[model samples]
Target: MSWKKSLLDWWGSAGYKKCSEKNRSVLKAAVSLMVVLFVLAIGVRAEKSVVIIDDGKELAVRTYAGTVADALAVKDIVLLNNDEVTPSLDSALVSGMAIRIDRATDVSISVDGRMLPVRTQCRVVGDLLNEAGVAPGPEDEVSPALNSAVTPGMNVVVARVVTKTEEKEAVVNFETEQKYTVNLPQGTTRIAEEGRNGTAQQIWKVKYKDGIEIARQLVSSKMIAPPVNQLVMVGSGLVVSRGGENIRYAEAIDMVASAYTHTGNNTSCGVAPHYGVAAVDPAFIPLWTKLYVEGYGYATALDVGGSIKGNRIDLFFESYNEAMRWGIRNVEVYRID
Candidate 1:
């Protein structure tokens, strides 16, 4: 107030009234410019209103700084190497401007026998894999699930699972069947039908993990061809006439026959060796059993010999010359029931 009164008094003085109109106009213009400069200075120093979103948290800030970087610096917010910032740091600050910061997390991915270390801002595991350029197949197995939240230092594993169908062919064995008949000679057998092996197909489901087999299951089995059963005809018994006598027997055996004379040794059953007596293995024919020979006459089993085994018989002859003459022959033996 005192300065304004003094300046007004001097301007209205008689000496000052003598000034020219051009000088007065110059003075008025100078005062107006001074007032405008003061107003501009005040506007430049005014504070700006801004909002900072740091890791999903909103912070309302009134900053006197000029740029976004300067505003964050004022708040002592430091940016890391992997951190993401929007509305870049160099941009000029404006009233009500929004600055966002997305924090990155460190994680590791294990896939296809590889370890990949990465830093990402993705929150979900699936999104992190996508960002890392790792794609999982439909049948692949993933650890910690794709929808789970991503954590720091987490290790994600992907296992490749595969399933395959395998077909194999195998041989099917045939069965044998026996049929009894009295039409054929005793101890004789004939094949009525020949046995044949058939073919079969098997289907298996095999599962593999990382190129290694994990499980195998048989899914189906089908016969390609039915097997043929073998049919055999076996002789039960027969009646035959030898030396004008009819002999009915239960079983017959085709055996090798040899002749033996007296060796000054009695039979094992304490009987003197004589004609119509045969030496046989007790396992094949019991002692004192009735028997008939084809080339030789009927006889009884009264002795045993070490050389006489299965399907072999020793016929007794009265003389050495006769025993030599009947050296060895194949003959049919019949057991009377």
Candidate 2:
């Protein structure tokens, strides 16, 4: 049958006319059901919700209009060099889509007060400082020791020390009063002993002024040589004896601190070649005063030079040559300050 004739013939039939009211109602219901099915089949659809992880943060993109790229751009999610994403930007967004972005960045860290440039994925406090070449000095004090936890900003410091040894040479002048007896008489040459007199030592109290032998008053004197009085006949006018006889006389003693020659060059009254023994003339001279001798010229006594002590002077000679030359000569000394 023709499509139009079938539709008209069905409409004119008793099934259509006798039950027209009921049929009309049923037809209306059927038409409404068909429209509802059509609308349900193809209509505005709801977009899937997309979850993207970017820069360590989760971003939700709901109602994604187009592709994954469009979704990201729509959500204002920009991709950086170190950022990572799951289901790349080109992938289409689906329902409950999860996109993950791993973000990494170049960071400069200050380790123990020292600025260190490094690349790391660490987030804890202990691992950062070890990567940087930073160490603490032994004496340097830090807020936290080497084992302490490190943070973004920390401080450190260091300390140092130096040492030295020194040596110095000082001279101390000293003296002692001494008296010796001579057998020969004054102005007259007469050998009373008939032989040369041997040298004798008599200790005396000697005073020093500023490490110098100023005045030596004899405290006591003893005759080391025997008494010898020679009777000489004078032919011309009688010779008058101005000075007293060289008889047995006692003199006061004066002692001054003095240093002795440590070097075996034991020549009395001369400079010592070495720093053997030391003494000081506390009465007049201060310790460590330099001295020069006049009668016996040379660097004889170094005040407080450790030996040549008290009134007893140290006479310096060129060598042992003149040392023996001026062996026991009574000489005057001068202070050079």
Which number leads on TM-score? 1
Residue range 43-75, candidate 2, lDDT tens digits: 324566877777567776677355577777787
The window of 10 residues in a row where model 1 has the poorest summed lDDT is 178-187
Off by over 4 Å in 1: 1-66, 69-82, 94-100, 168-201, 222-337
Question: Each prediction's Cα lDDT score?
Answer: 0.87, 0.45
State which candidate has the highest lDDT.
1
Structural RMSD, model 1: 17.0
Clashes of each: 0, 58
| lDDT against true structure, model 2 | 0.45
What tens-digit string does per-residue lDDT give for candidate 1 at 56-93?
99999998887889999999999986798888899888
TM-score, cand. 1 vs. native = 0.39
- Candidate 1 Cα deviation (angstroms), residue 293: 28
